[model samples]
Target chain A: MAKRGMLIVLSGPSGVGKGTVRKAIFDQGGNDFQYSISMTTRKPREGEVNGEDYYFVSKEEFEHNIETGQMLEYAKYVDNYYGTPLKYVNETLDRGKDVFLEIEVNGALQVRKRLPEGVFVFLTPPDLMKLKQRIINRGTEDMETINKRMTKAVEEIRMMQDYDFAVVNDKVENAVESIKTIIKSERFRVERVFPEYEEMLGDK
Target chain B: MAKRGMLIVLSGPSGVGKGTVRKAIFDQGGNDFQYSISMTTRKPREGEVNGEDYYFVSKEEFEHNIETGQMLEYAKYVDNYYGTPLKYVNETLDRGKDVFLEIEVNGALQVRKRLPEGVFVFLTPPDLMKLKQRIINRGTEDMETINKRMTKAVEEIRMMQDYDFAVVNDKVENAVESIKTIIKSERFRVERVFPEYEEMLGDK
Candidate 1:
């Protein structure tokens, strides 16, 4: 089998532009990486394709996967279950493609607990004010909701120490480039390389 | 004070083209990294500079620095003392310049003991046979000496697990690029960034 790929868990406070940065990374063709397809119980929205956007599944199927231990991490939100499926991630990694997951802090923490070997990268805005501005610009949340999100973002940013890497989302392109560099370096980590190549040096 | 710079320790088996890769990195202007000059008790060879090539110091001076803990790591070789100067390295780092030390396995291990936070990178040839060829092509060693060096190289390469990262010296430019990415990514480590900028979010 090819060498296993890195499980890179990217997390950040809300409105840190994780989605924008992720899209930029893909558009740049920075490296050979696979986006983890989340299994969600929510119905597919317009233009959303199954397995590309998410593995849209029935609520019962999602629960079954969780019970069978096929979910790396899962969370229930407003009667919908969303989670990272272990089957696809493991297969992609076995195929020698780094797996990328964009998750929230709590979900990232859960993945860390289960797989400490995964690289946990926390994304943050240049500052809290910038994060607030981003949320305001979205125009999807009310003033009260924005205030609540701002408070939550503060709490999440404060927990960055738990992450392996912290990147500032100052510009989408810069953030994408930073993450690409990180993944490239991570592939060369000693522990990750030793397992596959150590036996070849048996004469030593 | 400026942000503390990274301590990058580069090591590899002899004849792995470490010097070539190092020069390539510098030539490419990969990043702002300072080559650490060693303090040596050995008399300067022809055309070697005092502060640039090596800080050719008196045996007494070298011993005094070691006794005063001004030497980060020192090794006595053939009645000559060679070591990294703690004072110079600390000053460079405090000035926000990453210090790059190209040393052998023993010296790298010593530095790792004294400073666990240092980034230790081990460069390896694509394979043992390739390494032997590189050593033979140098034209400085006889058959017996070349054999001994090859054996030693195997031993050192086996200890690559002690390093934080490893790069295959397939091509000089590739190895240089690998190190550059590692250095770039390491600057974003959570432990390094959190202490410096976490407080900026206090008002949030």
Candidate 2:
């Protein structure tokens, strides 16, 4: 029997280099990884592909999916609705491909509530100052915004207890390696690997 | 503050190559690993060192430690007292070095019951046939003894649900790699790594 894939929920505060680490994993050919494309009511920015970046949909369609229970977990931020579609994750895992969900803390909590078996990993910056510096380097947000983000980052770090693993994103390559090791090792977990043992026992 | 070390309990049926895998890890410089030497009543082999191979002690001393709860876990196997001393494991972990216990299934279960936080790993051969063949290859055990061992091996594999991770000892190097990965990832566990986050947060 083929082993089923794992659902890895990756969450981090903004400016924690989650994007860069995730990209590095893909660049290094993260084996059997399928990033879950989220569905959003927000309009896609210029050069953003509809299905690639997000499943860009109208507010009516998004709300309909939420009502129909198609959304695994969804939340409204500001004026836009963002959520993970259940079908994509389920189908990917059915194909024996690991699904990576890069969502915020709140959405990750929701996923945890819904899919308790999912592996929850929280990425954190090396320190608050480094996080602040990274946000400043972006040049898109003002000082006030950066300060607010730093405070929120601390609060998020406080919620680390809810996660299964905490990864310090000091270096993108190292962080990616850690995550890959985690996933590879998780495959050996008794709960994940036990079902196939019945036939493989080879004694009967 | 430095991270506290982990207690990794490695257990396997006879002829599963547990010893080979363990030695391979050490040969590759398992820098943080400290094998927990068990106190035994049985006489050591001619070339076996006293403290290195086994802390060969008198039956009276081994029984006294068990009665005083100084032994973490003990078993009387074939009139020989074998048990892990609580002091060595505790002191080594206090020094921030991971302690590895290579014990049989029953002893591993006792450790799990005593220290629920310890990581339990079960090792098995690639198949029952291979396991029986390995037992026969020992050349010391007679046919009847080998048959009994094979039956016991099947029974032991059934108890694998009590373990956290299961490694198939198909190839010694691959088995060692799997165990190393498990320990490395277990270090990132939130419960183990969260306390350090408070100081790393930089606000406290």
Candidate 3:
């Protein structure tokens, strides 16, 4: 029988470069795994593709998924709906392909409650000063917004206690390598990878 | 204030090459960190030093340590006592040096319950066939003893669920590298290494 794939949830504070680190993982040829594309009611910005970047759907379609329990977890933000689809994740795992879901702490927690066997990893900046610098360096938000984000970052970092593994984003290369190592190491977890060992022995 | 060192406990079944992998970690200059030298009442074998391989002590001294609560956990086998010393491990951590202890699963579990913050890693053989072969290659025991050891090994492998991390011992180099990655990555855990940020923000 084919082995089951692992469900990995990645969460971190904003501006911690989770996107960059995740991109590096994919760029390093992690295409065998499925990157979960979330469904959102928000309109796509420039260069965003429907069903590729995100499953762009109307508010009605999003609500329909919610009603049918098709959406694993959903929440409204800035009057737009965003959620994970249970079908795609389960299907990918059934095919023995690992799945990666990048989401916020709250969403990750919700997904954990739904999929208790999921692997939860929290990424953190080296320090608060570096986190603030990264946020400001983006050149997108003003000082007031940056302060708000920093406040939120502190709260999110506190929630890191819930994660199974924590990776520090001191350097992009190091952080990406750590994440890859974590993926490989977790794959060897005896219970997850060899659950049928006892049954196999019993059959013998 | 200087950062506190992490107490890492490594455990695995016998003949999993955990000792070889651990020696590689030290040989690669990772021994700048502390390796806890366990105290044992067992008489030194050929070429073994009193304090280098182990803190060899008399049975009276070992019993005294157990009475005084100096020993973290101790077990008796073949009419000899073997155990970890709390003072050495705690002192090393207080000095800001990472302390690595290669112990059996029971000792690791005891330390985990007592320390609660120490890292626990379980090293596993590549597979059952390799594990049996490694035991046979040791040539220290008869076939009957080898079969008994393999049965014990299966029981120990079942307890892998209790470990925080698992590394497969397929190759010495790969196992050592994976363990090094785990240690380096764990150094970034927010709670263990970043408690000051919480203090700076006045959050517990």
| Model 3 TM-score on chain A | 0.83
Report the C-alpha lDDT of model 1 over A19-129, residue by residue, as the tens digit: 788777777774688888788999999999998988999999999999999998989988999899988888988887789998877889889998799898888777654
Q: Candidate 1 or 3, higher lDDT?
A: 1
**CA lDDT, candidate 3, residue B75:** 81
**Model 2 per-residue lDDT tens digits across residues B1-204:** 456689999988877777788778777883678888888999989899999989999999988898899988888889999889999998888888889999878889889988899999999767753554566476766778677856776686688889999998878888988999999999899888776656545532
Task: Find the 10 residues in a row with the least total lDDT in model 1 chain B.
Answer: B195-204
Q: What DockQ does candidate 2 score? A: 0.44
Q: List the residue pairs that clash in candidate 2.
A: none
Rank by TM-score, descending? 1, 2, 3
lDDT of 1 at A203: 31
Docking class of 2: acceptable
At residue B41, candidate 1 shows an lDDT of 93
Instruction: Give the poorly placed runs of model 2, Cα more than 4 Å off.
Output: A128-154, A199-204, B1-3, B128-154, B198-203
Comparing 2 and 3 by TM-score, which wins? 2
Q: Give Cα distance to truth, residue A95, candidate 3, Å.
A: 2.7
Q: DockQ for each of the predicted structures, in order?
A: 0.48, 0.44, 0.30
